[model samples]
Target: MMSVTRPYQLTDLSDLMALSATTNCADPRAAYGWLQERWGRVAPVELEPGVPAWLVMGHQEICRIVRNEQLFSRNPHNWRLYNEGAVSPDSGLGPMMFPRDNAYFADGDKHRRLRAPLDDGLAGLDKQRMSRLIRTTCAELIDRFADRGRADLVNDYAAIIPMLAIAGLFGLGPEKRHELQRGLLALFGSGSDSQAGNETVERILTEAIRERRAEPRDDLTTAFISHSNLANDYEIQQSMVLMISAGYETTKTWIAQTLRLMLTDTRFAGRVRGGRMGVDDALDDVLWRDPPMANMPARYALADCEISGQHIRRGDALILGFAAANADSRVHTEDPWLEVGNRAHLAWSAGPHSCPAHRPGRLITRIAVDTALHRLHDVILEIPADQVRVAPSPWTRCPHRLPVSFTSAGAS
Candidate 1:
């Protein structure tokens, strides 16, 4: 059901335009009939005349590209993206996601510098301690919501858990946790009124950064302060907000997606609840059947380079098919149409600009799903299976809301 476009099929600008217009295959494999109709192997369908960065779909090709970091990258702008009124690089959010060597943004030496603080925060006593804390947080949340099965899964469970867990990781004390959570919501939740909400977030975070810098605490905020390279309070604050916001939202989506599936698939639900499979495996199944779609928005070309026999020129914006790549049958041992194991998909992605929080995210995913399965052993999602929908962002896919009933594992 995977379709890569052929160059001959889309021979002209009109054809390319039509192809782009007609293509709405977010997770094309999610609907096989549609995939069979629209999907084809990617040809020299020119994004950049000669330098075609193969939009790999079959699991094998994605794996190959992932392993071959020298070939592809997560960096957004090697080429020019159309002008969208972005501010100058030196200004606020200018040295942001693009062209920054900070951990996820920078490659080579810059990335090494960025990884230190995260490694410190996650290393030694802290890492072990954070896991237990996450477990406790999950238990506490389940205790609070188990009796009330009508809670919103996205907000009540998935959204809140990571905030609390990360807060604890940063050693956020009682009062600070709630405040940090609010700051996070305002910044990340592009709610109905995002403009005002985001400005409020920036204002509060900048102020908080100043305060934290003045009276340095043991949290990641203070850790950023500890770093000599992160001298300016604004950059440190902005970067943290950026990383945490992206990290939080994507993780939230994955959890909600997996939990929703368990709710909808009673047999699958029983398999996890009855301890017939590991939580690791369940997480794998989640990625294959309903992976995140929030990986959209990309960078422009940096130079004219040839990839897979295609010429990619500077100034072109390229979109990678992350979800499709993960599900491609070429790399999958099982029938590509069926649910599969975690064959190490690009859910966390790979490469220098790959997600740095992959370590924490995976462990966190395991802890959350494992804890939930142990406690809420019989959650059955109430929505009709076929009618359950996946919301399409340019990148991430998340259930709108998961409604379910459950048989509690007994009062904790």
Candidate 2:
């Protein structure tokens, strides 16, 4: 531990790297390595420009912070900068970092209370029905471009399937589903349109809640509206927001990343095509190497403490470095044989706030990947892997586009 502990001054801002830039870089692992070498496990970083926070990179250190709620809380209300009125409502971080009524921003009993509706709503999901919905959505999406013999998988396929399937569960029609998808993409992009996007999402979800209350149906929206744990309309809407945004972004990224891996890495491509390794193996491998939610925001320190020799002040924000922790050399190795079937990565996160939708997320990703690979013969990236661009955001590391060419019956 390098015991350096004092409040950061404005002058210190020049030295801190923006967290978003690191993850958006060509080699994030190298960026993480540079941070670790310079500042040990916990390194100082900026969310935007002067908005400072610590990015926790060590696997053990992250486990400690997440597992002990007493020391670190998920509620963003504890964030010093936000409480100090430093973060503007119009800031790009608003959609992601601001406090909300959902479980993602609550702590203790309230967290469990808000989380129940999501847990129950998802648990009540008809797995077979959901799978069928996903498969059907996949086929429909592929048919749109299958005839052209080429497609941008990220936009045309990976991005659309998750939202469409999720909307199907909400019993939304095509118009509303498309509306919801557009809103969420802008919201997660965390750009100038984020606030507007958020408003659109809230409005759509609010309408769903109102309809469900008036005439309940056999859908997740109705299930959420009727869940015993949800107390009021606000809670219900926020819960849906959390479920849809989190599920859509993460699952979309998982599918894109897995496809990228299978298409780029001959180890996976040959094995998967040869029946030596399963698609599940490739999915699991992506979780370890490139999790959808590369850096999760965030946990606030409840009390001043020391971690990895750095003095963490009370109310300081700590971003969970999932991608970095997954690469922790102490827990991971370069040996490909040893990595197969390994489920030790922090991609799904850990502790109470760990992703509750893992089963459904995996189910969705697996079906989407399997269906695409099987249907699109000889699918291959149109550009070099290094040329692929990732969407710019403070939290997730998703590809912006994945253009590919393949053989189809309609291609003459």
Candidate 3:
């Protein structure tokens, strides 16, 4: 275990905390090095006003906690603060930390049971067919704004593709598809109505569940409804909500971030000049520096344990500092350009609860970026790279808008 210079402090815990569910989430980079200098790897901190948890920044330490399900659990119900009634149910963090009936909040056998349907659903997808769908979808999205020679790539392109594709997979039509997209975007919450947005998404998904139950289709909703583990309609609805939210937000961020990287980063010049990187390289870089989910919330310590010299009490919540952990000095190098193919970053997390949709997410992102770069000539960021505004979320650090200028294909 590493030695700690100062013990974790709770003074000013209320003032120091920030909500972890918005684009406005605290930048881990700002405090990662500082925390490492003092508290070493695992540092104690407040998740919100009067809500405390450990921020695990060490790469190895995060893996240890994620993999050891017996020692640590994903169930937020185990959280001492929530269980003790310190973190109120109506808090902004409720959307993330509060318990749900889905696989995201389950543990052990229950987790496996809930997760199996999701795994089976993703596995059942035809890779070539999905790729074709993404390619066609990207082409159409590009065509919509290609003539303008400028567009908000985040909203106009990256944001729309994943939901459409995922909705198609779920056999939903245009009405439900658009509603799901709107609900999901609002669920990420730039405004004060995040809880309402959460309710909207649940209501929409519940309706979809009911519709699928009455008229079965060859889709994910059908699969969830029929899955043996999910016994009730509410369970099915929750599972669908999990699938849609997970698929939608994560992919949207991944696509937007990768596109942002390609346009702004000099290394990925998009045309392979000298050692200019490709879209896949940019994708890897995003996973390392700015993953879709910067910090995943609420893993409770099953019992008293020490991780990398930080003492964690039983039922204490630990935030998997994915962005911070990826930059851990011990495992990750200081120079980003040095390790080209190195993929040790914990972007999709580790252990049983690791992202199940990573494969499809990568495929969608790769195709979106590839098609956009090829279809649009000489794409460049409309705003200065540093000035690009991110949405207000504590967990995800996605750009709110990625406006860019490009030569029209006809002009080129």
Best by lDDT: 2
Question: In candidate 1, what are the lDDT values of residues 1-412, reduced to their tens digit?
Answer: 3343433322133323111211234435543323323434332223322222224334454444445434444465543332333324433223223554345555446656666656554543256767787888778778777877655666678888777777665556645666677766755454565566566556656765777768976567777777776647665765666556556767777788778767777788778778886677778777666666423334344555543333445554444556666656655665644534436666766554556576677777778877776677556667786666655343556766776667664554
Score candidate 3 by lDDT: 0.78
Q: Write the per-residue lDDT of candidate 3 for residues 293-388, one digit (tens) a residue.
A: 888886898888788777788888888888888877777566866676888989899899998988888999999877887788877898998887
**What lDDT score goes with residue 21 in model 1?**
16
TM-score of each: 0.75, 0.91, 0.87
After the best TM-score superposition of candidate 2, give how far the Cα of residue 60 lies from its true spot, in angstroms.
1.2
Model 1 reaches what TM-score against the true structure? Answer: 0.75
lDDT string, candidate 2, 1-412, tens digits: 3333443433266688889877799899988888877788888999997799999998999999999999999998899899999898888888678988788888999888888877788899899988888888888888888889999999999988888888888878778988988898888777799899989988988898888889998788999889889888887777777787778889999999888888778888898889887888878878988989899899999998988877788989999999999988889678977866778899988998999989989998999998888898878899998888888887878888999999762211
- Candidates 1 and 2, the one with greater TM-score: 2
Model 2 has an lDDT value of 0.85
> How close to the true structure is residue 16 of candidate 3, measured as C-alpha lDDT?
40
Clashes of each: 28, 0, 11
Error of 3 at 303 (Å): 1.6
